[model samples]
Target: MMILVFERVIVSLDLENGLYQEFSHPLYDYEPANRITLGVLRDCLCTFSSSEKFSDVWIMKEYGNVESWTKLLCVPQMGGCGCYIYTKPLYISEDDQVLTYFFKMGKFSLAVYDSIHDTLKIPAIQNNIHDLVPEAYLPEIYFESLISHFSQD
Candidate 1:
């Protein structure tokens, strides 16, 4: 089982050997609200975050080795405005280099990060994304349940 010590830091337990190893960023002093997303892209372990001055995408070149961790990309927040926000990885391009992601502070539009070119492109009007808001499939309203489903008379 995998246990996430902090929001960004991941720790794994070896059941057979009863050994524990750090699988993510060593530093633990970060805001609890700050979120880091982990995924497997291009067959490599990757994590993305926008909690710092710049958005950083970290990739573990050789798994289980902290030294092998590398910052794949460090994107300046809001083009260097310094407003930190979360950026979630959506998918990897067919070439396995370009990464498509979504910025938590953006206008609900998809942004493509070309790691090879070290560039970011957001297709707003071209992609027909305007005033897009993330929400659940079903609209929800807070209310009290009048009956219990588990009670047997």
Candidate 2:
């Protein structure tokens, strides 16, 4: 099994024997290594890259195969403002809409991209209490716990 690690380059770490090897692809070579963010989309290792005008999402269809890398989607920068620094994919729905979190001009928000229509939708999320807003947000996939929190004793 390969565990993806992001260092100066993408590395595959072998857990059993503790070996490290770089994961390389011709498509990834064009961008600076630091600009690439490793993630898992649809259970496959994926990379997110943002340029001045667009953000790209790439996925490796087959694990440990460099040739399996495929460009999944290219999302244009919202509003053509050129202020977005990063766009990270959070989830993909069964209907093929992609949910992404983006940072622009020091603020972070979520947007959904429809691949079928090539449209980006920024939904309004609000927190009524000003003090509850976080300075930064890191989204992750989480499962609801079935076990009760109350002590049995």
Candidate 3:
């Protein structure tokens, strides 16, 4: 059985070159059960589930590398790379407990590092991402929160 399940959320960058992609989820570690065994689907993207969410949902969009600085129309991005819309589902414990071990920002892009798999998942906005892999800043990520959102079926 597949342990991990994912959902896709989106962020749009208002830019010249508009493009987008859908983020992919891992094969394991996102199921409802007791004592989930951590498994690696790729060299990156890990966890008991990709179920960490703490943001306002929005439409997904893309932007260009260079922005109109003189006109002050576009805001500068961190990586300047286009990103994919992702919906990540989390694991609600049998005891009605929600565990969120990811990142979140007010309006800025959210990025995280999977220590178990050793990779960084950065949501790009420019259009230079060759492939999604764990990044060098993977060690800076931490567990966000653990709340209550479970069911006993």
Candidate 4:
């Protein structure tokens, strides 16, 4: 299984045989302020998010191969808009064209990352969300809305 340790290091493990191995880690000097999230797509496809203005989406083509970590796409932070501090890949489109994510910037928002066009789209939500306060994971101060729950399945 894939594991993200200390929120910055990614590792793989074998629970049954009590085996584990080091895998990958971020190369940049990280601050707790930035949102860095990891997720597993359908069929154990792995993805990583570099939650920033010029954000990066990384995918693991080969499950346990560190060399297979590929950059799926780069999402430019919209003009003066809040960055996605938290993100989760919901599902890939049936046609394999669009990817939907439960992304949070200042408030919980939805981002549809289209692979065919290499673009990110935020869908309109019907709820009246409150203005969100930012919270940074980096040592420096920053602000954004916080998400409380996520499903394991």
Query: What's the TM-score of every candidate structure?
Result: 0.53, 0.72, 0.17, 0.55
What shift in Å separates residue 31 of candidate 3 from its native position after superposition?
Answer: 2.0
Please list the residue runs of candidate 2 whose C-alpha ends up more than 4 Å from where it truly belongs after superposition.
Answer: 1-8, 26-33, 80-83, 126-134, 142-153
lDDT of the structure predicted as candidate 2? 0.70
Clashes of each: 0, 0, 24, 8
Ranking by TM-score: 2, 4, 1, 3
Clashing pairs in 2: none
Please identify which of the two predictions, 2 or 3, would achieve the higher lDDT against the true structure: 2
Look at candidate 1 and give me any clashing residue pairs.
Answer: none
- RMSD versus native structure for model 3: 21.3
Question: Residues 1-153, candidate 2, lDDT per residue (tens digit)?
Answer: 999965454677665569877767537424544456778888777888877667788888877787899998777777664336555888877777889877755566677888889777777766722225544456666533322356699
Error of 1 at 8 (Å): 6.0
Q: What is the lDDT of residue 74 in candidate 4?
A: 56
| Cα deviation of 108, candidate 3, in Å | 22
**Candidate 4 structure quality by residue, lDDT tens digits, 1-153:** 998656445655665557876767434333424466666544444444544455555666766677777765555555444534435455556544434444354455556666677666776655334233333221111222121245477
RMSD (Å) per prediction: 12.4, 8.7, 21.3, 10.6
lDDT of 3 by residue, 30-125 (tens): 332332223211122233322222111111121211121011011112222332222231322233222222322312234443334433355454
- Of candidates 4 and 2, the better by lDDT: 2
Q: Report the error of model 3 at residue 109, Å.
A: 23
* Candidate 4 residue spans exceeding 4 A from truth: 1-8, 26-34, 42-45, 80-86, 94-106, 115-120, 124-153
Candidate 1 has what TM-score? 0.53
Each candidate's lDDT (Cα)?
Answer: 0.55, 0.70, 0.28, 0.51
> Taking the tens digit of each residue's C-alpha lDDT, what string does model 1 give over 27-100?
42334255666666555667766555556667777777778777766555555422235456655666534434
